[model samples]
Target chain A: MKVYAIYILNKAGGLIYQNDINPGLNKLSANDYLVLAGTIHGVHAIASKLKPTEFEPSSKPFGGEKEIPIESSATFSSSISVRDSTINNDVVNGRWNNPNTNNTGLRSIETDLFNVYVFQSLTGIKFILITSPNPIVHNVASLNLKINKGELNRQFDLAKEIFHNIYVTYSDYVMKDPFYSLEMPIKNNLFDSKIRELAK
Target chain B: MIYSFSIFDRHCNCIYNRRYIHDGPLLTQSKPSSVNLKNSIGDPLGVSITSLPPDNGSGDNFSPLGITTKSKESGSSSAINGPIPGYINKYNDSNASKLLFGIMYSLKNITAKLGDLASLFNTLKSFSTENFRVHFMESATGLKFVLATDNEVDNLQHILKELYTNYYLNHVVYNALSPVEFGTDANEHGKISNSDFINATDSFLTSLSVFK
Candidate 1:
């Protein structure tokens, strides 16, 4: 999904990065950002279990959940095995060549105020990207919607592709630069340029 | 005395035996090397190891197998011929030879195994020096290799000195013979005998000797 906002939580549940690219969302104090990321992660996890799930379909053995999978719901096809647990479902079902992971955690939340995308690296470092949702994202369809609507969900694929590009750009520019420290704000010239291009 | 001779088809003890430089270290006496004699018919990949005398600090008058002495002078690329370093950032002839040596470690033995490299061997001769230049005569191609270095040495002893000066060299070499390999009878003199170097390098299986 095109990430509207990003939040990074340390393995110990400390928020590492929180940013709002769009103008609509309200900004938070640095400390409050941490508390918000941690609380939301815990709360979303609990809420997923409580969210009403649909009965399994008789025709398709895999589609046992409700008519629509919650945005955070991750599926692992029995075919692939992911040795690394850090990668999110959005990344795996999306583009990774390695085996699929059964578990996909809360990568983001799209609310009226802001959108958040969470990325956890192999070393337990989290990256959160927060951006203002396009006021125009009213009818954007996601990956599963292709299977459900049979209408060819091009917009959802485009959005996920955008996230993939952004993720790779962040990894190359921010993560690899020796000067940048963990959980710190990225100020790389390349990152700034690419983000601006994608923001457009 | 260093003239080359075709050793194939020579008889054992057909000629007079005299005190040679390498007799002490080599296993066979007045005989063709055990391994060379085997490959006399034909063994293309034959290789052996021979023991070389310890380093005496001289750069010229030295063997490729010798290690750097206590002076701990570090080597640099393209610095082989001159005191000044040349820009050979990529590995050239010097490094290519090093890589061949590395490959030899893995593939030589399985290809061909010869006993001794020479029927007679000569211990490596060395002289010590702190100067930039070293004088060397190659055995394989009979070429001379010299190098100039930057390190300075003040005492100016014999090991690194010129060959013509009688007292210039601090040490002399005998042959490939070591007491542990040939037994105590081989250790009669501190120096190696000529027969040793001949035998050490005689066989295609040259690396078999400790000299390698």
Candidate 2:
């Protein structure tokens, strides 16, 4: 759960900001970082296109009526189960209230050593977080057991919180600066300190 | 449910590829209304495929406006039906397979380089988009097994290992007539054409709980 690095890409897919929060990951050259950012941006776009087609059921007169209730109940039970296991009801409610705001592109990449999470804002700015693999996932990898969905959801919730904080800080410090130009590299000292604080 | 499975040889050549056509109740429930509407309006799948824009290789210039415009057009034109899922034998050389391999290759390399240099097997295991999750496993011999399933599915490493040690070893590796390595030339691309192996894999995969 250690954040290794953070990369911010503008709406045009340009790397506007890059920071190494921790020392676990190897440092990439500035040019290489730009390439990485561009690559991620490209991959994110391509991934949306690669989305698999949903299964379309054959025509049935009564099929629609029977299926709706069951599906709704399944979601209801799942949500209830999740809520029962955690005290953070507000986060769950917040997630459900605005489902469309969820980024419909590449979300996370998990590896043996680390995980990369991509959070795209409504304006299309991408917040990329490279971190150590979730401890729950690591445990499942070693134990060869079924992954606990609750733990994974908690990890995602934590990530969402971090991204939300980062977004708020960005809007406050970067967006409000009179000298800062849109889509340009961020160079604010206050913003830098806020990011560092969040990392800590 | 699992949508597709692919195997890449050490050379990064896709040796075996299988996509499952999933029309089950579980899959339909995800977006019931849209799928039903699309299906009822006379085979949107075929229409979508035919109307797909050509690959102009301009993915690098991805902008928010471009994505929104494209999605909106597609959404309005056809009710957004994804490609069918099933263990189909043909179309292994599709651009999707190539792109998938390219992604895995680059991401694996990046992960290995970024991690502690002393560790030997620092490879990418899985990546999830909003649509699906891809579970990956690589043998010491460099055969890569990739499984793309719905986001609910968890790590499939053990399943992959079982396929390797049990099915793959017994069917492809030990068979006397089978080629030792997949393809040497560009045309053939070293596809695994063994029916027994294919059938075994199909049955084994279908038997899994997640497959239902």
Candidate 3:
């Protein structure tokens, strides 16, 4: 849940807003930030358009599905009976319905230091969320559950929430203001404070 | 208690719309109507739809010109029928979806006029009063996401964004069949056809706290 920095790019790949919430990452020059935003935007466009290479599933889907029922059977039945099964079904179905199936859109790139997540708005604005790598590994290990795709998907979903909030804030505080021109840099104090609040 | 959700493109055309009916408490407080009274003046007991419920009261204070009713009534006549007649309705009897989009569109433009503070004024995310809350999210390109919910719902911006990411972008924008071209749809106007996205949205929304 530790977001390193956030970068917001306009439709033309211009850096409209950039902030480093958790300091320590090497800072880039103003020009360099622009380049970074453009590069990421281009790469995301290319990636999203890339045709996926299908690979055979190494293990059968049912093999993994059977394990969940037996492991959490007791807890599953004790909850709200209506939703428990649907939740379980989502977990199972999500295994095959990975949103990043094509591997086209840049989802995340992980390193020992940090993880970069790219969220593209419908109109081509890109929100880049850089977070600490392996934020959930220790917790998952302590829980004694084998870390897998499910864990990563949950993390991705959480990052989407962060990006979503940022998007909302950006649209409200930046887009509505009559003084703010499109594709221009955002410098409002309220927007900055709101971003800081979200970081906290 | 969200009754409906809608998305409008930059041009203000409704791109996606869906209605959710809940059996729980209605957000608008319907007034007790004096109905079924004998007409001493010889007029038939035709339903006059009197007391067409307060449009959630003070929310319409912004419409000083009194134009919302004239415009909304004309547009709604063809699209919407009153919902069971007894409940106070936030929108008019015509097209509830269109009115929602119209309000959001006008509000977006009005709020964007803050000049230097304009940068401080971001898009209208959501505005809630009394029992009803309407959630909103706009993309940099002005694509708007709107949803109506009960005031108790939290983190709804995430859900709206999820709808933008998982549903709209994936199904409408990415799908070649459903081109990003607005104005007219080759398939159907203001209709989205991706079942995968719809089902996922249905499940996700139904699992919300507001629904319960």
Candidate 4:
């Protein structure tokens, strides 16, 4: 079965993730996905900035406490680009001091003849997966099945399974990460290795 | 009620100590005879409640110093603590209610999102995907759940707070294991043996206890 593309968008609709799985599907210009991610990123940033503060005048005596923390500039900025490939290789090679710390970027995408699956998280991370129209993705790992048509259902399931697997890996390596910036592109090579393992 | 040491009262066999205080020419007792015992580790010993019990006046049963005692013998060592025998107990007995409640509360939260938590801390917590999944096996009368991450204490604190406050008696206990060994580990009943589960239970309980 043929799987096509993967795209990850931050909660802001910015295209933080875009990758073709099959490599045969129509390819968007490299800059197009980046522009999409940037636009969404800008919109999300503005939305957060524009969020109205809830300040209700209370008749009750104040507890002598206020809610807002002084908004100083963030310590980490988007300009800081750490290569995922370097980090992952360093970790696998045992060169990095911290094993648990690293970026696990966006979810995987799968494509087949029919539809695509996009998995989302509560934190507004979007994982887009495209897969074959068959049901065989359900049992993607089953080998040497003599019947091809009978396995179609299994193919679809397998694709779903792959997405689920990818989702799990994403949450484990990426979402749970405290250091990872929100709405930023993920670049960890460990994720790449896991995906390749999943594909195999 | 200074339970400075000696906490495990699982059998409620805590021995009480009674001492005397000087009441100006007359002899009065010191603190109440309350025993401190611990079953759940990390829970705070309930407040030092050597409080005197209230007197039952025409049945009003209220006192300003604290709750009144019902003991007819006012000088009795055990009777000094309270109106009823509920002396130093956080509520009635030890505050196992709060500690176990916290654990159970956390368990509810941890179990509710078992699969979700599997990926985050599985490696540090020493569990795999298949082993973390919790599906009820009615026949074996057991359950399974994902292990929490030991990589960070903040996350464990979050889980513990939820459990201690929302604890309840649950017959089902969960264990974490590797995916490949999930079913094979369950010989016939689809659940880990009681002894195996005990080890896992001790692991979790000990973690929470120390964490507390």
Against the true structure, whose DockQ is highest?
Answer: 2
List model 1 lDDT by residue over A1-200, tens digit each: 33344444656666654445444444456665555666544533332221111112224222213222221223332222243453576475765632312123333332333344444445455555544433443233322121112111233234445555666767787778999977555557777776657756
lDDT of 3 at A137: 35
Report lDDT (CA) for all predictions.
0.30, 0.65, 0.51, 0.32
Worst 10 residues of 1 chain A by lDDT: A143-152
- Model 1: docking quality category: incorrect
Worst 10 residues of 3 chain B by lDDT: B58-67
For residues A88-134, write the lDDT of model 2, one tens digit per residue. 65666654221212233578888767788888865678999888887
Residue A68 CA error for candidate 4 (Å)?
Answer: 35
TM-score of 3: 0.36
What is the docking quality class of candidate 4?
incorrect
- Candidate 4 lDDT score relative to the true structure: 0.32
Location of the lowest summed lDDT over 10 successive residues in candidate 2 chain A: A63-72
Output the better candidate (2/4) by DockQ: 2
Query: Best candidate, lDDT-wise?
Result: 2
Q: What would you estimate as the lDDT of candidate 3? A: 0.51
Q: Where is model 3 chain A poorest over a 10-residue stretch in terms of lDDT?
A: A63-72
Q: Which ranges of candidate 4 are over 4 A from the true structure?
A: A34-114, A135-156, A176-178, B1-212
TM-score of 4: 0.26
Identify the superior model by DockQ, candidate 1 or candidate 4.
Answer: 4
DockQ of 3: 0.01
Provide the lowest-lDDT 10-residue window in model 1 chain B: B1-10
Model with the higher lDDT, candidate 2 or 3 = 2
lDDT of 4 by residue, A1-200 (tens): 55555667777676765556555443446675565444333322322221111112223332333222111112122112233445777778765321111011211211122343334444546655554444443223323222122232244345556666777777777767777776687776676666656655
